[model samples]
Target: MNNQHKPLQNGLHVVVVGAGIGGLACAIACRRANPPLPVTVVERAPEILTIGAGIHIPPNACRVVSSLGLLDKLKQAGGYQVKGFTLRRYQNGNVLVEKPMGMRMKTEYGAEWLAIHRGDYQGVLLEAAREAGADILTNAEVIGIAEGIGESFGKHMVVLKDGKSLVADVVVGADGLWSGVRELVLGRSFPPVETGDLAYRGTFTREHLKSFKNERIDQLMEAENVQVWLGPGRHAVFYPLRNKTEYNLVLLVGDDLPEGVRTSQGSLEEMAANFEGWDPILNTIISCLKSALKWKLLHFKELDQWTKGVIALLGDASHPTLPYQGQGAAMAVEDGAILALLLSRLQNQGISDVPDQRNQQLSDLLLLYQDLRKRRTEVNVAGAVDTRHYYHLSDGDEQICRDKELASLPDSAWQGPCSFNWGDAEYQKSLLGFDGLADAERTFDEWSRKKSRQANI
Candidate 1:
C-alpha cells in the first residue's frame, strides 16, 4: 500500500486496475466527467517504463483520444501522420493495394490517422491521467476482488498483494491479457489461448539503413507512408516513428517457439530467413535490427458477460484480439472511452439517489456497455482473422485472385461486405469511420428515457 496517499470515499469511486493505455484512458475520462468521478489506477509495475515499439491510431481511436484531450499532446510527441499504406508483393515488391490515409482520411473519416511510438503514446496518456486528478498507485498488484459481497456489497473489496484492501463503487478491469480480475469475474481461471502465430517486432534508427535502399524504399521513406508486405504464411508492416528518425517493423509468422514459451529473444538471422527472397529494402531494414522480441498472438473466447454486479471488464480483460488489424490497443481505448462515458453519467445521482436506483442504473449501463461493445469488438476481431487469411495467402490461384480483388476494389468507403481484406471499402469504413463513444451516448440516453417511463419516477 502507498501510505503517502489516501483514497476518496464517495459515490462511484472507480478502481481501474492496470495503468496501461486502457486503464489510463478510463481513469482520465472518468476524472474529466461532468461532475468528475474519483478514479484510482492500480498498476503492478513499480514505475511506468517508456516501453514498446510502434502503434497505429486509426481515425476511430483518434476520436476517442481527442475526447481524452491528448490528441495535441500525441501530435507534439512526434506522431507521424501516415499518408497511407501500400500493400506489396513480398518477392518482387509489386504494388498490390494502395489507398490514401492521413489528411485524406480526415476528410473521409473526420480524424487523421496517426502512427506513433507506443512508449511515447503511453507516456502522454499517463501524464494526462495524473494531471486529471487520478490517484495512481504503482506496484499495487490485485490478488483478488469480491463484488457485491459482505459489507462491501454494492461496493467491492479489491485485495492487494500487500494485504491492503480498496473499497470501490465499481471495479474496472483494464488489466492486460493475463488478467487476475478476469479470473475473478469468471469464477475460475481462464487464460488467453494462443493463435498458432508469433509476432517478431522491433525498431531501427534511420541512420542504420546503410545496408539497403531502392526505388521502393526511397519512395516509401520519403512519403512517410506505412508499408506492408503480404506473403506466403506471413505478413510484415513497417512505418516511420519519432518524426521519421526511427522505423518500426512488425512481422507475423507461424509460431515455432518452444511449446509453452510465449515470448523470447528473436534472432536477426531467423527474421531474415523468414522473409528470404522478399523486398531488399525490407531485408535491409531487418539487417539493421539490434534486438527483437517474439510474442505469441493470443485471444480469449467470448465470455458469458463482461459485467457482474459492480465489476466490469475492460480492454484485454474482456476481449483480447489478434494484431491482424492493428486494433488491439485501439479496441482497448475505445472500450475505456465508452465505458467511462456511461459510468460518468451516474454522477450526482450516486449521492442523492437511493442505493437501489444507483446500483440498478450502474448495472444496466455496464450490461449495456457489454452488449454494445461485444458485438463490435467481435466484428473487429473477426476482421483481423479475415485479414490474416488474405495477408498470409500462399502464392497461387487464390493469392492471384485476392490481389486482383484488391486492385479492383473501390477506394471510397462503401456499404456491404468487404471485397478484399486489405483496404476493403466497407471494412475500412467500419474500422475507421466509427464513433463508438457517440453511439454509446445516444443509446444511453434512450436507455435512460425507457427506464423513466417504465418506473414512472
Candidate 2:
C-alpha cells in the first residue's frame, strides 16, 4: 500500500465513484477550484456508454458550468440552446402556453438553458476531467468502504471487487441514486422509492420530423423550446436539440406505474400507451422508437445526512430530484460546483495540521456545504414534485383549472424574472459570493461560545 500522502502532494486525494455526468462533473469542478486538487474517478463499467436520452440543463446549471470554463466544450458535446417551452393539448395540439428560453433566460438569470443528450454531456465532462488531470479508472468497482484512523489517514479506504484498494482523504459518492458509498455512509440500503410516475424518452432526427412541421411542431423543432402536450394521466414534451438536427421526446405517465422499475429504466410502451390519444407527432415519435427505456420517477425523501466521517455524497447520491422541472442534472451539477468550492476552501487551510484541528476543519467545511445547499436543494426538489403533479393532471375540468392557473398571468406581466422590478443584479452577486465556509465556522464557534457562557450565567 502507498503508506504515505506523499504522492497526494499536500493536496486533496479524492476518490469519486460512478463516473456518470455528476461524478465526472464533480471531478472537473474540483480541478477548477482556485487551487486544483488531485482527483480519481472510479467507475464500475469497463467503459462509459451513452444510453437513455436527452437531458435539459437549465440556466442555473449552465451558469455553474460556465464558471468552470466548459461552455465551449459543453457546446461541442451536443449542447444546444432552447428558445422556449410550449404547453399544449394533445388532442388538437392547441397551444395553452409558451415559455421562451435563451436570451430571455440569459437576460433574466445571466445564463442560458441548454439541452443535450445524456451520454453526450457525460462524454464532455469526462473528457474535461481528463484534460484537467483527474485520474479516471474504469472497471474499478468499489464493493466496500471502511473508515480510516488518525490524521492524514485519508478518511476512508475503498475495497474493490478485484481486491484492489484505494485510500483517499475524501471519498465522494457521486455514484447516482443507487450509490454503494451512500449505502455505507447511511449504514443501510436506502434504495430509490418510486414517485408513482414513469417516463418514456426517445430522440428523433430532423428528417423524421420534416412532415410534421406545423406551428406546434415547428415551434418545437425550430424554437429551442420544450413543448409539452398534456393529457389525462399523462404528458409529453418535445424539444429541439443539436442545432435542430434532432428532436428530443419525453412522455410522463402517472397511472399504472410498474412495480419494479428503477427511475432510470421504465417501460416506454406503457408510457406511450398512456398518451395513446394524444398528438399524432407524439404517436409518430413513439412509433419511431425501436425501444423506449423505462424511467420510474424517484425522489429522495430521507438520507438527511449527506456526510459521515470523511466520506460525503454529491449530486443524486445526496439528493435525487424528480425530473418534472428538468433540473435533475442541473441540481447535480450545482452540487458538484458547491462541494468543490467548499473542499477547495478546506484545502486552503493547510493539509498538515493536528488530528483535532483537521477534523474540525473538515466538519466546518461540510457543515457549510450542507447549510448553503440544503435549503436550495429542498426548494428545487419541491418544485420538481409540484411540476410533476402539474404535468400529470388528468384532462377535464380539473385540467382546465390547472391550465388556467398557469396561463392566468396577464400580458402586462413580464415574461421572466429579468423583466420583474426585483434587484436581480444584486441578488446574483450575493449568490455568487463564496463565503459559505466562513459563515458556517463563525456560526458554529459563536453557538459553542454562547452555550458555554450561558452555563456560567
Candidate 3:
C-alpha cells in the first residue's frame, strides 16, 4: 500500500509529537486510511535511535502489524515465533509450569505471538511510515500548542522549541513516559510514580550462547521458548530475539539506584549477588552477559480523560503501563491503530462546514476513543500488577497454590478458569483476541448516531 494509493485527502493535517513506535504506527495507520489524512511527526531527538532490548508482538498487536502489511517484514527482521513459556524456580532450575503458545496463539487468538528485538520492530514501522508518506521531522521539539486563535478555527499551532510552528487540524501526544505533551494537555506537570523496581536488562548474540558450550542454554534457545525465573522479591525473563539468533534477558529487583537517576550502568557483581544460589543455568547466562543497564520502572495512575480539545494522548503519555505483563508497547501500538481509525473516518462523519460543529465532532470522537480505551487499558494495568504480585511471590501457601494452578492448565488454550489470568482462556480471550480497528469502525458509527439522537432531543 506504500506509494500506490491515491494522494492524501488533504482535508486535515495531523501533527504527531513523537516518533517512537506508537507515534510511527499512528503515522502509518493514518496514511493507510481511505482518503488518508496527512501526518507530520515531530521528533525531539537529533536522530531516531534503536534502543531497548526485546518486545513481544502478542496476538492482539499482531492484528495491527498484519493490517499494516508488515507481518512478513517482522519475521524477516528476526521476529521469531515463541513456542512455549516456562516458569522455573529460582533456587534451582526446576520447571514449575509450562504452556504452549507457538501454533496455539494463532489457533486460539487468530495471530501468532512474535518476540522481536526492539530495534527490528521499530525499524520496520518507521520504514513503512515513511514509505506511506508520513512527513517525519527529527530534532524538532514541541514547546507549546495553541488552538482557535488568529481568525482560524480549523488549525492548531504547534510551537516548536526553535521558534518555528507547524499547523495541524489535530495534534497527537504520542510522546513517551516523560511526555511534555502530556503536561501540556493537563496544564500541569505530572510525574510517573516509581514502581520501586529496576530492570537489569541485557541482550547477547547467538555466539555468546555457543561460547558457553552449555547444552541447557543451547536447547532453550533452539526451542525459542519464553522463560521466567521466579524467586522471592525478584524475577527474570528470558526470550529469544532476532530469529532466535540473539537472546534478551531482563532481571527485575528492588530499586537501589540513586535518587532521580532513571538509568545507570549495572554492576555484574551486584547482578550476580542478587541471584545467589539460583539456577546455575540462569547464573551461567548472567555470566555470559557482556554488560547490563539498569532502568527504573515507573507508571502513571489512570487519567479521567485522554484528550484536551484537539490534542489527544496515546501510548505512554496517557497510560505509562508497567512492563510486568509485556503489554506496554502492545497497548501503545493498539492506541495508534484505533485512534487513527477514528480520525481517518472523520471526513466521512458528514458534518456541515460550520466550524463549531466540526470541532465538536472531533471532540466527540476523541471522547468516545477515551471511553472505549480507558476501561481496557485499566484492565491491562491491573493484569500486569496481578502478574507482578504472583511472579514475585514469597515462599508460602499462596505461591504453592499459584504454581499448582499454572501447572494444571488445560490442554486447550481457551478453557476453564485458572489462578493465572495470563493463561486462563476466558481472561486471555478478551485481551489477546481483541481487534481494535474493527471495534473503532463499529463503535464510532453507533456513537455518532446516539449523538445525533441526543441533539434532536
* Best candidate according to TM-score: 3
Regions of candidate 3 where Cα sits further than 4 Å from its true position? 1-9, 148-153, 411-414
lDDT score at residue 411, model 3, on the 0-100 scale? 51
Local accuracy of candidate 1 as per-residue lDDT tens digits, 1-457: 3422234755478899999988888888898888788889999989879799999888888989998788899999988688877888999778886776768878878788898999999999999999999989989999987554444555667888888878777889999999988888889899888888998888888766533556666566666777889999998888889987888888889998887788999787887799899987778766766676789888878788888777899889888888877788899999998888888765643433555656667777789889889998888888888888888989899988888777765443423354565555667777888999889989888887887799795
- Candidate 1 lands at a TM-score of 0.94
Which is the winner by TM-score between candidate 1 and candidate 2? 1
lDDT of each: 0.82, 0.71, 0.85
Error of 3 at 380 (Å): 0.5
For candidate 2, lDDT tens digit of each residue in 49-109?
A: 8665789877777887887788888898878887766788878678776655568767766
Lowest lDDT 10-residue stretch of candidate 1: 409-418
lDDT value for model 2: 0.71
Q: Candidate 3: deviation at residue 43, Å? A: 0.5
Candidate 3, residue 157: CA error in Å?
Answer: 0.2
Candidate 3 residue lDDT tens string, 122-236? 9999899999989898999999997645545556778888777777777899999999999998999998888888988878888988888989988887878889999988998
